[model samples]
Structures are given as C-alpha cells and as structure tokens.
Target: MAMDRELVTCTKGDGFWTRRILCTIRRLVRLSAKSSTVGNMAVLILSISCIDGNLLNAFYHAAPSSEIIRQSSMNSTISSVIFKDYDVTVMLFHSAYLVDIEQTEKGRVMKLDSLKNGDIWKTMDVLVFNSWLWWYRRGPKQPWDYLQYRSKIVKDMDRMFAYKMALRTWTRWVNSQVNATSTKIFFQGISPSHYNGSEWNEPGVTNCLREEQPVDGSTYPGGKPMAATVLRSALAPVRNKVQLLDITLLSQLRKDAHPSRYNGFKSMDCTHWCVPGLPDIWNQLLFASLFS
Candidate 1:
C-alpha cells in the first residue's frame, strides 16, 4: 500500500523541532508588538532570510510571489501589531510545480522533501507546510474523466499507506527533540491559482507581473472542486501533526480581487494570489494558531 503516483512526488514537510518553534513565535510576537520601531526593525531582519533568491518572474518564478504577502499579511491590522511585536520567524517554501517534488532533487531546486528528521528543522522557529493544487491537474489538457482519475490513483498506490509512511517519517523526526512544543508546523491548505478565469464562471484574464501586483491582504479569484477534494484526501495522515490553513475556501469567496482592473491588462490570475489580500489572511491565521 502506497500513495498514488500523482501525489508520491508531492510530499511537503517533515516536522522536526516543533516545541522550539512555538516558543520562538510566541516570544517574537510579544516583543515585536511592544514597540513600533522594534517590530519594523524585526521585520527587516526576518525578511532577509525569507528570500528564496532563485525566484525570477512574479507569476512564474518570483521569490514565491506569496512570501512577501505572507509576511505582510501579518502586518495588516492588529495582527501586524501582534506579529511585529514578536521575534518569531515563519519559514515557508512555495512554488508552481511543487507537486513535482522528486524532480527537485535532480537540480538546484530547494527540496522540502529532502529534509531529514533534525536536519533543516533545526534552522527555523516555525515551518509552514504546503503542497497541492498541481496533483489533480492533467497538466494542460483537462483530462476531464474523474472516474479514470480516481481509478488511476487506486491502481497506482494505496493512498492510506503512503500517508502512513510520510506521517511516520515526519513525526519521528519532529518528536525526536524535547523542544517540540516550541516548534509549530502549519500546512497552507491547497491554494488555488487562476489558470483561466473561466473556471470561476468569470472569464477575463490570466498571468501576473510583480510590479503591477496588488498590495498584501487583498482578495482575488481562484478555486476548483477537484483540487480541493484531492487535497482533503491527501492531508488526512498529517491532520494532527500540522494545522491546515484553509486558504482554498476563502479564496473562492473573494472573486473580484483579481489584478486585471488595476494593471489595465487581463491578468486576473485565478491560480496564485495577488498581494494585500488572501496570502495575508493565511499568515494572520498562522499567527493566531501559534498563540491561540
């Protein structure tokens, strides 16, 4: 019994030092909110390591277009005050073909799956997990047969068994340390990006440029039932080990947040999010999960 091939390559994070991260996030948050200057200064420090450097284009390879927003998302309202007041750091990795996790090992890509138990988990205070949205896709041709898809999954591997191994690996690695309570791991539930506006019944635009993007915390369109269903099923094993950030449901509600209107071009991307909206909500929720 093993996970289907579609998701075999999509394994995301192996939580190692959970307790240490939780404490760090809590402390940083408390300290950052005490003073505006301290918070802003802390943001500068945290933002430096947050950079992936390999990112090139915003829509395509831009340093995880959502990273800046995920950070800024914490700065929006009282949440900004809360996050800035602390010295906590959220280390996350996101990309377009992340589901292709295996191919990552072959090149210069930063592979989240390659992380051993205590290896990189020791490097950060909190690790935000994510990976999905690309698994159920037929790539480009819309392999529209759902039954065929499900059968393909069952025939290829036993989904439950695959999850068990993944969870075992992650739990073993994360629980090995006593400071597990300080480390917190969260999985940003499958985020939908606008591939074509037609999926939402609003046909208009596609693609995004970093310069013309919206600020952090703004909502926009993008979602699909198939992707959500697949993610829900795949996330079953690590349910207790990681908090699921439900960005999929929220993104579906904010349909008008697309960028076509601001940039004057049909760039209403539905797959990934624009700044100042959804990604911020994701970050805010991550912060609240740590404290509350």
Candidate 2:
C-alpha cells in the first residue's frame, strides 16, 4: 500500500502579459491497482518528491529550448531561473514561516526571520504560502524553542497569539515589500487532520486508520479548528495585500484521502493528504483563484 509515483506539471506562456498556469498533479499510483485508459492517452508513471523542489524541476526540464540563465543546487532553499525563450523569470522561496520563530535543535534554540528580510519577495511575481501544519506540534516534536516578541523572550504564549504575531509580521512585510498591482500573493488556509475519529462521528475509532471513504456531507461534523479562526482574524488587516485560499472546510470532509495505513501500519498518519488525492483538488482551487 506504499505510495509509488507522483506527477506534477507547470506551464508558463511566452506572452509577457499571459498568466502562468501551474498545475501540480501529485498522483500516488499503487502498483496493485487496476490500470484504466482515458481516450487515447496512456497514464505515465513518474516519481518525484513533494510540490516545492520537484515541481520546479519538472517545469524547467519540460522546456528544453528555453535557456536557463541561472540554476543552483536542488537542495537550496531558494531557486531562480530566467527563461530567455519564454520571457519569464521564475523564483521559488522556501519561507518556513511568515514571521520570526525560535527553533530548537540539540537543546539549542535558533531564530528564523520573516520572508521579506531575505530579499526574495522583491523578485517574486506570484507567491503562494502555507504555514499551519508545523504549528500544531507540541513538546520535542515542535522545533521552536520559545516565542520571541518585541526583543523579549516569552517562555510560553497562546498558540493563537503566536500565530497572529507571525501573520501580522508577514502582512507588515508584504505592505512594505510587495506592490499589490504587480505581485500576486496567496495564503493557503489551514489543512485539517482526522486524528480524532470522534470528529467524524465514529466515537470508538481512535484515528483515521481504517477509513476508506470521506465523511458524506458538505461540512465536517467537528466544524472548524480554533487555529482557522486565528488565521482568519490575522488575515483581516492584510486582506488587500493577500488572498486567502480557504480550503479547510472542503478538505475536512476528506478523511479517507490521507496516507493512513498506506504509508505503513507502524503508526497512524492522519495529517498529510494523499498525493493525486485531496491536494489535486486544492491545486484546482488555487488555479481557479489565480485565473479569476
């Protein structure tokens, strides 16, 4: 039941004014599953990592005629390329958080700063970001050491407060660094998890281990998470600078879409959705937003 292959496709037009259509198809092909043909096309099987690095590589490699002005290591947090033939400058930045946060490593805390400070925002024509999954980790699993506020360290703070502070910092950065007319900014809403089976109305079940179908409804029985509320409130001030892709409610119904036992029976994984599964739906929503 292990995930076998993933496919992602992104295309940029030759016209200067044309909007880029980046379609990421993260398909997890299981070997045992029956093959189905659509029209005259045969489904191609390719293997790659998640959306960030692999997607960029696929986009560049697909265009052999385009001259790559600059190319760097695959491991770098930021990557840029100038396509001479397409007249497009594409840059990708891996900003783990919108604001500065403390990271704990080997009993040492490290401070990470905002995306604007890195000078990457200035070059981006389109920026899409998601920063909810990491915030839920607690204790050793959480990388952050302590929350830093206004040049002072706080031993502990409400998660909502920390999230809002980071989001506001990001908005302030956007206000100073981004031009709303020229740059497109998007914030993906919080992705919901199905760890608690009671959330889906199956009280005895501990997690999404044996779930094979989504909760049948337009809304989740558990409603929304508190973090989603915090996110909406934080984005209020910067609604002009950024667009929120609210995918939470739709994604919440997809309890069967997670990796679950497909990853292995070792532990229940109800967090990350299966590639070519729920994430594809998210990308479609993202694509529609960009074009709209």
Candidate 3:
C-alpha cells in the first residue's frame, strides 16, 4: 500500500540541534543581532515542529477551534520558552490558519479572502512559519468541512488552491504587518514523505521501512512536488519580506530517515520523520537562515 496522508506523532528531537538553535538564538535574537535587543527580543514560531518533546501544532489529530489553551491536559511551559542566559521569549503556536471562519446556513466556512488571524503574527521580532503537510486532509481528518472563497461557500476546493489561498493570506499579512526594518520572517517549504518508492527511483520498494541509506546523489529522482511549485509561486509577492527555507529538495533525498516500521506497532508511520534525525538538519538550516 501507499501512505495516503501523513501520520503526525509526538516524537521529539535529541536536543543537539535544538540546543544549538537556542545558543545561536541568543546571539541573533534581534533582527540585526544587536546585543542591546537580544535579551528582550521576542520570536513567534508558527509551525508543526517540535521542541522539548512537544508538537507545535500536531494537526492531523487537532480538534477544530484548537486555538484555546487547555491549561490542564498539556504543559504550559511548552507554549513559551526562555533560556538561562538568553532572556528572549519565544512563543510557538500550532497555527496554520491565518483567516476567519463563519457559521453559515452552509455549515462552518473558512473565509479565504480574509486574514482575520493576522494578529497572531503582528509585532514579533522574528516570525518563523510552516504551513504544509496538513493541506492533504480529508474525511474525518480534515479540519474544515467548508471553505468560503470569493463570497461562495465551497464544500471542498482543490487542495492546492486552498493551500495557495491560505499562504496568500499569510504572506499578505507578513507584507502588511511585518516590517523588514524591525521583524525578520521565514517560511518553511513543503515537507515530503517517503510513502512511495517510485518517488525516489526505487520502483520495487513500497515504503521507507527497513531502509538504511539515503538516495545516492544530490538530485532527487522524483524531481519537485507540485506543492513545492505552488509554495514558491504563492510567496513570490512577499518574497522580499519573508525568507523561504526550501527544505523539500534536500529532504526528498532522505527516504531512509522516516520512522517507518521502527517497530511493528507503528510500522506504517512514514509521514513523519524519526527523532534525533532529519529534524536536526531542518533546524540547522532554519538557524542558518536566521543568522543570514
């Protein structure tokens, strides 16, 4: 079989890169790496990533209107972070939606034409965002059942189109609310899964199970996913304002890195990566971009 969708988990990194990111963060907490502002600089990361063993958003199982903090079931410390030496406050939200929704006669509707959630990204010294992977949702897993676009309520729009509209709303907010002189912005690229072997030129294989080696070269045999193209095109309008951390191509070459069949209990979990592995590289790249 093949992985129809991603299976997000609560796995965490091994702390080598996570700690390194924090160390580097102390140096460049501000947009200009200014010592005066490093101690007080604030960063807001909107992603599905994990830190301290907590998933940022972990949306594949998230209930609708999950923006509300539970305060009981989850630990509060995960939402905000502060290091001993660095006084920066970093807030991580599992937010991919940057628009509003209204309850209409047609059920819940997401207004793709509006950015009602722009306030989430406003006034932060550094904003890092990742909004892919969840775009492929459907059936019980899909968060929104209806999408309101151009004044029309749609039962379902093309995933690519919906993804584009969501990013467009976010990029528009970045262009409008995020000032380049004050805030540094970054957008993570589409994350890839190794469900189908053909994508990496291994036609006989079915998944990442038992794989122990990377694709032998720099170029991924599968070329680029259509989502990657859409991601770049959507960011074109605000590219100057938001830096793109294009991790897809390099990640596509790591079919062997997924936590696929590490044990029989969760063998088919090919969508997410293994902890102490690929996420380190992703965070390394993210830190590099932050310094640049």
Candidate 4:
C-alpha cells in the first residue's frame, strides 16, 4: 500500500504561501527516489486564499506527469489537479480568512468564515496555517463590514482582539474535529514586511523596491512585530496541539526578497517575497519538519 501522509498550509495570497512550498516539495521528490520507492509520496491538498489559475498551471507543468487533471476553474470555490504518476493530488479551496470575519471590497461587505463546515478538514492529515498583513489594513484598504463577535457587531475592535478571537475559533475546531494522532498541524508564523527602511537601519529608503539582499545579521534591527507576540499569546493554549513554524526572525532579515515593483509597479509590494528566495527556505524548514 502507498503510505498516505497529508500536509496542509493555510495562508493568504498566491506568493510565498503555496507556490514556494509546492516547488520545494516537487524538488525534494525529484531529488529523492525514496519518495516513490518507500511508497511515501505526498499528496498535497490546499485551502487556497484566492484563485490563481496561472500558479496552478505552472505547478502542473513543472511536475513530473503527462496526465494532469484540472477539475475546476477560477470562479469555482474548489479546484483539483492530479499528477498522474507521482501519487500527488492538489486541491485548492478559496478562503480569505481563517475564521468567520466580515470583509468589505468594492463597496460590498463579505463575510469570510471558517473551513469547519467543509469536508476538506475531515481528510486533512497535516495542516499549516498563516494569517497576518491583512489585519493591519485600515479604512478602504481594510475590508470589513463590521467586526462580528458572537451576537455583537461593531464598527471596529482592537486588531489583536479580533486576531485572538479568530484564532480561538480555529483552535476550537481543531481540538474538536482533527485527529491528533493521525494528523499533524502547523501554523506558519507571521511573515514580516520591509516597508519601512528604518526598520533595517536604512532610513533613506522608502520600501523594498531596489534592494537585492537580506539584512546582514541573525537578528532584525527593529525587533519582532507585535503581531508575532499576539500570535504566540493566542496559540499558547493550543501550542501542544499545533506546532508553530517560527519563520518570523529569519524572514525579517530578508528585507530585499520582496517582489516590490516587479509584480505590478502600481504600488510597492513589500508584503510578499520573491519566489526562489526566502519562501524556499521556509518550505525547506517545512519539509524538514514533515519528514525529518
């Protein structure tokens, strides 16, 4: 029988979250014949934040398979693709938030909910989740009709409070539903951005635009973000159940690894990292945690 192992990574955006990890897995499989020989090939299933057909296409094409299956489209909530010979099946689900939260976009307020109701969680054997960057937005950039808590709805609440509440809901679902023995869960820690040059001791720079190297040190000059602290605090109760992939400090040093203007040039994108860059390291760490 083929050894079945499941891994899940939850994060926003198509950049550092999914593609980098996918690429790392693909490379590892290619390098190690042990993956197929030991009948331990990985079948990656994802709960995607948004639909990016191009990213899926790129992954499928780069993989070692002739019979590639495309089961859904951009508008669909779920999409599946199978790598015929490699025993890899990737399913992408559309989700913007880890828990039920109200988001406003283009004058329309949308309610983002948890994946607890979905059948995806039932089969999830390994899970990795991330949420940050989105929580910092304000005004029109921050898309939310109103903060929803139980029976109460407010115009706004403390970002940390909302984050902690959302995490509480998520942990509750995991504790109740997920099989602790069969499944392994991980939370990808807050990925830091290099928007402020002063954070890295360069005050004159505006953003991570033309920078081409990471900050030279083991520690970030500006120290960790309060979001990271909030994450740890929220996860404290459930830390035993879920492992935290602490990529914050390491990622903070990679100030120059962002897509910056190359992504669009419309605005500086210091949030997401460059593909064959820092995220690759993140995935390497993930791969180590999964197999080693």
Which numbered prediction scores highest in lDDT against the true structure?
3
* Strongest candidate by TM-score: 3
* TM-score against truth, every candidate: 0.45, 0.72, 0.79, 0.74
Q: Once model 4 is optimally superposed onto the true structure by TM-score, how far is the C-alpha of residue 49 displaced, in angstroms?
A: 7.0
Regions more than 4 Å wrong, model 1:
1-24, 28-118, 133-180, 195-224, 261-268
Give lDDT tens digits, candidate 2, residues 104-197: 4523332323443336554445667767776646788665666666766655677666777777777777777766664567787888888887
lDDT of each: 0.38, 0.58, 0.65, 0.63
Question: What does the lDDT read for residue 172 in candidate 4?
Answer: 74
Per-residue alpha-carbon lDDT of candidate 4 for residues 45-143, written as tens digits (9 for 90 to 100): 444321133335445545445677778866686677776554555666555457654334533332223445335654544555667657757877765
Tell me the lDDT of candidate 3: 0.65
TM-score of 4: 0.74
Error of 1 at 134 (Å): 6.2
lDDT of 2: 0.58
Lowest-sum lDDT 10-residue window in model 3: 57-66
- Rank order (by lDDT, best first): 3, 4, 2, 1
lDDT of 1 by residue, 1-292 (tens): 2322212222111011122333445565444433343342221112111111111011111112223323333523111111222243333233322211222223232222333324544344455555443333443432222211211322223333333333344444544541434344555565545445455444664433222333235444343455456556655655665566676767665555544334434444445443434544554565467665
